[model samples]
Target: MKRTTLAIALAVLAWTAWDTGADPIRLGRGIPWLLDFVRRMLPPDLRVLPAALVGALKTVEIALLGTAMAAALALPLGFLSARNVASPAVFHPARVALNFFRSIDTLVYALVFVAAVGLGPFPGVLAVVAYTTTSLAKLYSEAIEGIDRGPVDAITATGATRLQILRYGVLPQVLPLFLSYVLYRLETNIRAATILGFVGAGGIGFYLQTYLRMIDYRAASTVLLVTVVMVMVVDAVSSRLRARLI
Candidate 1:
């Protein structure tokens, strides 16, 4: 069975590569042009440093605010969706709603909000909030459901109210995981916010798109570098915090 499965997977991969016109010969031919393009991006014109930094800051702000808003909204939704916390009636519907939210791409949300709210970082924030809420809520629900039932049973045995039980039992067990997930999502949202800016949702992506359109690879490279640095810093910090929490 394993051999058959592996053969099937390889066949599908080959078919996909062929269908997509991923010719190795074509790739080899493009190497020179690719190298030339890379050469053009060398020494990334630092003249755009100030503007790129500002955009990087704006991207961070959008992600932070959006993640905060999503956490606020997702917490209650998560509790409601958790099988151990909410009734089956509530759980099923809430899960369905989360599924619906997860189905739509974040870029689609950004575009829709840009139309609704007009162009700015606000639309990016809204898009991130919508996308992150669904994602975080689903993750939080799973965390809540997977927690140790020992404390939960003890609390329930004490005749504690549902809210009290959640506070005393559930929150303690899941808060670390919740924070880890939020931090991870924040990292993801930063990248997403940058992309959303291409659609005028407002972020470093605006500058990136502008520079690219004008064939200013130097300026575009600066923005890309700033984005990479910002994401790396956040990831490092979040990783440390998660380690401590766990």
Candidate 2:
């Protein structure tokens, strides 16, 4: 049986490789171009520090606002989607809704919001909120499912309603995990907001895009460097906070 299973797995892998058009030669052609691009990016310019700093702050604001909005909306939706909280009849539909939202990328969300909001930090914030909500809701629901049931059962035995049980039993167990997830999402949103600016959603990415359009590699390099540093700082802080919470 073990040998048969191994043969089947190898056969499936080989078939998938062929089906996906996994050609080593085609992949190798991109390496030279990538190397040339990296070579040009070396010794990043720092002359545009002042402008970069301003843009970096805008990006941070967009990310923070967006993540906060997402958390507020997701906290409730997460409970609705959790298997432990939701009835079986509702669970499938709720899960499907969450999955549908998660399927869309933040960049795509930014594009839609940009059209609707007419290009600004507002649109960028909305985009981040959409993406972050889907992510947090799914993760939060999973965390809920993973929690111990004893507390919930005990609360129910006391004649507590579902909402009461959730408030008294479920929330206490999941709050730390939820907070950790929120911090992680905020870190991710910072990077996403930077990219959204390229679409005129407003952030440091806008400056980077403007410089690139004018072929001002030095200015673009400065913006990129500042953006990277900002993201690194936010990520470090978020990681520490998440560690403390979880």
The lDDT for every candidate, in the order shown, is 0.93, 0.90
- Give the 10-residue window scoring lowest on summed lDDT in candidate 1: 237-246
Instruction: Compose the digit string of candidate 1's lDDT tens values, residues 34-86.
Output: 99888898889999999999998999999999999998899999999999899
TM-score of 2: 0.85
Candidate 1 clashes between residue pairs 3 or more apart in a chain or in different chains = none
Model 2 bad stretches (over 4 Å): 1-45
lDDT by residue (tens digit), candidate 2, 201-229:
99999999998898777778889989989
Strongest candidate by lDDT: 1
**Model 2 / residue 151 / CA error / Å:** 0.8
Which residue pairs show backbone clashes in model 2?
A: none
Error of model 2, residue 162, in angstroms: 2.3
